[model samples]
Target: MRKKVVALVAVLAAAAAGVVVARGCSGDGTSKEARPANPNGEKPASGTSPEDAPRPMGSAVTIVVDASAPPSEKGPEVLFSATWGGSRMNELGRSRPDEANPEAPMSLAMDAKGNMFVLDQVNGRVVRVGPDGKPESVIPLKEQEAAQDMAVTDDGKVAVLDRFNSKSIVMYDEKGGVLGEVPLEGEGLDELGFVTGVFVDGKDVYVEKEHGPLLRIGTTDGQPVDRTEVPGRPTRDGLSYIKAGIIEPEAGRMYISSVDRATMQHRYTREIRQGSEIRGILLLDTDKTGTIYLATLLVQNDQESVVLSCHEPLKGIPTGTAVLPVNTMPEETFRDMAVLDEGGVVYSVRTEQGVSYQKYDCQ
Candidate 1:
């Protein structure tokens, strides 16, 4: 039954390609309210329930997705919204295209200044948007095929994760000048895994290396600082592999996700490596709070995903647990997640159709 479901999901995702503007309900089965109350206690027309109030469901947080603006004269204006409690998304704002291409968008990043950086994977270029949803600049990369994940620094430096060449992480100045590249070394890079994402803090950069572990490196000279092994084994069902990870500097927390594992064959027999059985999002903290928040999705036997927060008061000690409510897209699967200073999260959901950008505000 699990195999059948997984196969069916893959088929539906492949069919969603090329089709623009697809609509579906969230796992919670709630639609976007036509008129909803504002965060400041003002009603907008949509009905409001006390239950709708943003609350923490364990590690699973509340999110809202809105349609900000429609397609513009050049084309449909790109709008970003959060997928919170209801099915409907909240309109954050529309973003204009820096370069025009009919291909669907893959990923996006927003700076503190409201400047939007869009990664058009198909075209192998990065597009920038101004606060008013206008095109600011278009950055063309020399090696488009290697570009995978991206991050923008507070000082406006752009870092692109390349999977093709020896240069793993490449940094560029605000004007698109080559700053430097992080040399892939140490036990983490020696595994020769693909980098899923790159995030920059003040002077440190955190990288999620696929199939290996989380790597921390210095941005100034690309020197490796530390490497943390990712826990969890792949399930025997051969469902998915580890995809991406995120780190929160303020909270000293880390989250990792798995997608599918690979099967290996020897001379006489074939062996299947069980992928990360504890498949979901994991929260790791180094602040002496031995608590770990885990969000898991069972894909092989059952199609269910939940969030749980587990804590240990003292080292090597155990505490109680709590379950949280998390809503996911029916067709879209979450690939990456990042936590903010206020305990909020921004995640990337990838589907055969397109990539869905979602933000979760957790109290």
Candidate 2:
């Protein structure tokens, strides 16, 4: 399989054909969010594909966020309210810096039970917050070490990318005890660079390999499962070409969103509905029923950009049937996003002030 993929890549290179790779909280900052030009300078389709007809986005209501009124300990400052049977935004909690560590969160992940895990990059610790918005445990790391991304399994195993200390990934159990650590170099993965994405689906964990395929590791003992390579435009990283990606593993299919630096466009997999106006997909997540939610950026102009929360159906078509603009400051950056099974979406919006989390309840 690897040989076949490599051969296919070689053929694409010979033809100058564009490929798709996949992104996350950490990005390479080479993508322009507005719908980009076709890399091959060819028109593929309009808004719909021939097999699956296009569906108009029905009326979906959403709340707007006030940029001036900052989030407080009581809750985040939400500007608007949702009508009956519509989605409403709710504030979870906020943190402040302390002498022991900077409590600011860098990345966010959620488990099946709705427990949230936060990577405090400034403090070099992982804090698990229960569904009640209270701290459960604070797992510390080596001094000066920081986590780039993290993933949590359904059984309560947490895997964190400890980049500063030996470029290793540490795994911890439910009680925040160390299970084991895997160094990227020991195995046959010598070409691997900084891991930018980590995802936990069931008993398996997938880690993004810089310029390489997604490494699937078994959660039981942290052993190798296999590698998945998605072809796409590659960027020259030093002397080696690397592709930065964001990955989400569902029951059967994997959703990948990547940046194609060759054409300065953002790309998604062919499985998705074609001609969606996402421009750039920053976060990919699915609910328990297999509904896909995308936190995307739409660049309107050089000075204006809008972040959208979109919902795509699983079977009828992959196009977003309902879209909501996250009515925040155009300058606010998207940090992370997660979809709840019962019916809500949690995402982080960051600015110079700090990071704030807002939840939209569609239930």
Q: Which portions of model 2 show Cα errors greater than 4 Å? A: 1-104, 142-144, 186-188, 210-213, 218-279, 309-335, 351-353, 361-363
Q: Considering every candidate listed, which one attains the maximal lDDT?
A: 2
Report model 2's TM-score to 2 decimal places.
0.54
> Which 10-residue window of candidate 2 scores lowest in summed lDDT?
1-10
| Among all candidates shown, the one with the greatest TM-score | 2
Residues 240-301 of candidate 2 have per-residue lDDT tens digits of 11221212111111122343434534433322221123334445455665444444433332
- Tell me how many residue pairs clash in candidate 1: 30
After superposing all C-alphas onto the true structure, candidate 2 shows an RMSD in angstroms of 15.1
